[model samples]
Target: MEGKTVFVDGALPGESVLMQYSSVRGKFDEGYVKEVLSRSADRVKPPCEFFEICGGCSLQHMSSEAQIEFKQSILKEHFEHFGNVQPETWLEPLQLDTLGYRKKARLGIRFVTKKDSCLVGFREKRSNFLAEIESCAVLMPKVSELIVPLRNLIGSMDAKQSTPQIELAAGDDALAFVVRHMEPLSEQDKEKWLNFAEENDIHLYFQPKGPDTVHKVWPNDNNDRLHYQLPDFDVELAFHPMDFTQVNTSVNRAMVSLAIDLLELNGEERVLDLFCGLGNFTIPLAKKSKAVIGVEGVDSMVKRGYENAKRNNLENVDFYQADLQQDFSEKEWAKEGFDKILIDPPRSGALDVVQYLPKFGASRVVYVSCNPSTLARDAGVLKEQGYRLVKAGVMDMFPHTAHVESIAVFERNN
Candidate 1:
């Protein structure tokens, strides 16, 4: 212990515990708590029965407040270490439901001949095998309740062994499940699935090939999309089952409100939103600003953004398609000066785009980041470009996991 570092899975800070080593390395060792001789006040008994084995959640052992504090410390450390700067104001941590908040998930499906049944849930921790779980604590109650019924439904199907996964998506008033089957489903299997959907009052879909092959199987309705609303902005977004949407509805709503407030947009200001999928922030910004431009890399999402704008009757917003990683200064949208900018890039961060933010002549920038390290690195770049980090804080978008979702606001140092 004196010569090397040890990473314990279940042990908390300031606690003595007996641990069993699972993996040994030259630089460090990995282990889990076998016995806790001493405990911290922050430690709590995980509410989920499958938390011990399920890989879905890692920080369930820590109290909810402690988890938020831990994430905040991580963000602070990243800012100090990578960016060499700190925000002037540390915002209050944004949080919502600690459990039953996740509205989307990709659950594993496994047919075990030994048990003569099918298993449906997340994979086991540190293993490739699926965990045998009947209910999930983090998923929405409607989706969690479908686990056992989904298992039984697959078990009764002729293609049980071929169905490998189920994709879940939920909205304010609708829930949908997409069954990914490797083989063809018999007419009887289809009927069974339809009956299950009808009884559960949920939409059912089938994916015999790829994501493009996913099609609704129940109710035979023309509408194949699920929607969520940002009631504060009077905006509603509709998306297909395969489309990427925020998993926590409340957190997303709160995050959007925070980002918009940080921008301090006036009716005369023009705003630009980068990586704006389905006009999540752009349309809302349009409601408060004079004009808004939404740019995305994917073609389908660009179309979806336009479709949503039309649905909301928002003529002040426009959607554009561009690879942010490349130079886009020549484009008409990029040439215009923006009063404020909102960036919600992927995990890789927006280094390629952030480096050029100063050229856009934006007075303010609000960045929503999923990765602290990348955010910190980009913050350093922004500092060099004469933008001062003003306010920053973590959001409990993912409650019981190590994932850190944070937002930072920067004002141009004019």
Candidate 2:
């Protein structure tokens, strides 16, 4: 090993492997484990048949417990290197069922004439081509089992070549699939999908163009909405098929409970929820707090959030639309004061909104993040503003993948 750095894929920290270089750059080189001479104790046989070829999951080769520890280490390293700080206390990691937990995904579709079959699943590892898979184990069982059937269904259709992808979304009570078709479907093809939905007891939707063109195709009485309930708070959230919702429902429920506990509301405090999508956390926070104000970037989502609040009969919760990345300090909602703040911003982190923390005079802030580097960066800003990271921990929202979902509690310094 010379002074040059080699980036290896499919290699663990304590494994000895025969690697083959894939790319060599001026500063660093990239390689993959061609053969493992010595494997780590944490290595395990992946459960999915398509693990090696499909790019859907990366850490399926490692044990579940080991995966959590590795993610914790990644969080710690990000804090030390990017934020220049650490939490006063580390909370226990929140974990749940690892398999069949994904409730949402976008799968690629390709008709391979050579094989005289259709491939319906994730893309190939490190490639744009669709992976050849009959079924998937990571997706919710209802959706996973449909992979082969879907392939056959598409193969029978004349517009099979026009189909590019399938978007899946499952709520507590409903399963929905949005088939993205490049061309208009013939009546025969439409009947095929309708029968498929009827036989499988699943909802079918069609997307002829952009996301705005998505419409329900099956069950002429399509008034039913997709929803998930938080039994702890007696809150039910209804969402559009294209709306953003957590893939793992159990972990989401646990995460909301943990956030509420960290807030320690006494039914007399005012809470601020930023980047609140469909009022997932806002409605629950409203159950314990005196009042909750939710802010989001999208006008449609904000409108839906208000509808969710009304549907839940939660009069104390209000929603407003604002671009958090830009200056919104002049807005009425931004001028309001609160006792607690909760932010579940996108992967870019909440640096723009975190800067205005002092104005709210909130004593406690709960930050939920999907990306650790950005979280660490925003944490540093809060630290500079006299907020100490009280406790932080990771959530296994995405069990088999490298994505990290974490939450942190920051209390203002006296």
Q: All models: lDDT?
A: 0.92, 0.92
Candidate 1, residues 1-414, lDDT tens digits: the string is 778899999888999999999999999999999999999999999989999999999999999999999999999999999999899999999988999999999999999999998999998988999999999999998888878988998999999999999898998879998989998889999899889989998888999997889999887987898888999999998898889898999999999998999999878998999999898898889999999999999999999999899989999999999999788878899888888999999999999888999988999999999999999999999999999999999999989999999999999997
Q: Model 1, 319: alpha-carbon shift in Å?
A: 0.3
Judged by whole-model lDDT over C-alpha atoms, candidate 2 comes out at: 0.92
- lDDT assessment of candidate 1: 0.92
lDDT of 2 by residue, 1-414 (tens): 499999887888899999999889999998888899999999999999899899999889899999999999999999999999899999999999899999999999999988889989998887889988887888999888999999999999999899999988988988988899999999999999999999998888999999899999777786646899999999999998799999999999999999989998899999999999999999999899999999999998999999899999989999999999889999999998999999999999999888989889999999999999999999999999999999999999999899999999999999
What is the TM-score (0 to 1) of candidate 2?
A: 0.98
* Residue pairs whose backbone atoms clash in candidate 2: none
